[model samples]
Target: MSKKHLIDRINTQFGENLNAGNTCFSSINKSKQVWWANIHLSKFADEVHLLLAGTGHFLWVTLPKDFVHNLSETFKIREDKNAVDLEISADKDSRYLIDVKSGGTGFDFRKYVREEVGY
Candidate 1:
């Protein structure tokens, strides 16, 4: 899916207005763009969502509940009773890694975009 499609999914599913012009957090000159949001997922807890979109790829993730306090600085997420700790990063090859840890169970997922549909 394209970047706009991703944002549209969030809007339709969550009833929130999220778009590149508003949520972007990085330099516009670069082909890749980063965005973030604090939103509630279904009836669960509120969480932080980070999105990275580029020419041929888009990476989106939902962090731990209520963990993102600021957008201008680097921070770490801590596991608490309400939610797990989540960490996301990307390698030089454009592979994205997601790590989530709770009381005892934790899991991870990786993504590397090969193509985007509906562009």
Candidate 2:
């Protein structure tokens, strides 16, 4: 699927909760399977709940806002925006770099998935 198509799927899957209002951003690899996404937290007074549809697995992930506080501002998605170019590297400390093209930014959060939070 195309980038905009994929992002819309994710957003629609999370529509009910998104009533709180936040922008969801995403990017797809050339193969159109691998992808990375994030919800730009605004009015997210509770925790962050992500619905990654069509994965066939790990379809949902949830985390406290505090867990992503440091990198919260780096996430955003737009259909009109070009596919964001990205570069990643991990240091000895496991600190990874998410270099965005032309200064854009975002992510994939898996380990923090919580099954307990679901509709």
Candidate 3:
């Protein structure tokens, strides 16, 4: 994929919702035939930086701290509004990354297969 293609994919998924003073960054690995991009998703409380990489046929995404926080907040709000048993367990896997394959309409942690962090 070319740089433009990568950028367009991010734009299509995120639109112009990036936080103020933030922009996307990208690069290509000619040796491996891979393309990657770094983008920030805008939120009312914080900004989440995501890394998207495509290897000709498939694409993957890596979440940052803001993603975890945002997800946690979502659960917290849901629990507060409704009475239900809810639990969330997330480890600080600084090296954690997953493919955009099949989680849900968005990044799916349940279906994320560990790449290398653990066997």
Candidate 4:
């Protein structure tokens, strides 16, 4: 599919504003492009969000539920690696903090959405 179509599809699918990031994934080498999608899922809970990294020359984002149905039907995640990793710590003042590393199959956002979010 054309990059424009892909970007539109992605935006229509996951409500996260995507853009061309400086980082490029290995998969993009095969196709020669890079893109990223960041989404926030407040309905699930505050501060909870989903990030998508892929290889479409163009980028875009949308709501998970909005694009979930199409995503589930269109893409399939080839890799099972954790896309997002988190680390949690507690402080002496009874406060907790978390750190997250977001990485996963840098391919199709739809596939990532379906596998990660189970849409």
Measured against the true structure, the TM-scores of the candidates, in listed sequence, are 0.33, 0.38, 0.27, 0.22
Q: What is the C-alpha lDDT profile of model 3 across 1-119, one tens digit per residue?
A: 54355445556665634322332323334543222332222332333322233333323232334545344333322333332112211212421222221221223343332121110
Clashes of each: 0, 1, 1, 7
Which one wins on TM-score?
A: 2
Model 2 stretches with alpha carbons more than 4 Å out:
1-31, 36-38, 43-45, 55-58, 72-108, 116-119
Q: Write the per-residue lDDT of candidate 4 for residues 1-119, one digit (tens) a residue.
A: 44344434545776544343311122122232222222212231222223333333222222334433432233232234312222211121322221211333222333322322211
* Residues 7-115, model 2: lDDT tens digits: 3555586563432243232333444343354333342456654444332332345556566554425444343542223322222134233333234453544365443
- Could you tell me which 10 consecutive residues in candidate 3 have the lowest summed lDDT? 83-92
Candidate RMSDs in order: 9.5, 8.4, 13.2, 15.9
Q: Which stretches of candidate 1 lie over 4 Å from their true place?
A: 1-5, 13-45, 66-91, 94-119
Winner on lDDT (1 vs 2): 2
Across 1-119, the per-residue lDDT of candidate 1 in tens digits comes to 54567778767866776666433221122333212222222312443444555445555444444443442222323323222233333344442343322231223333332223222
lDDT (C-alpha, whole model) for all candidates: 0.39, 0.40, 0.32, 0.29
Error of 4 at 65 (Å): 1.9
TM-score of 1: 0.33
Candidate closest to the true structure, highest lDDT: 2
Span of ten consecutive residues with least summed lDDT in model 4: 82-91
lDDT of 4 at 104: 30
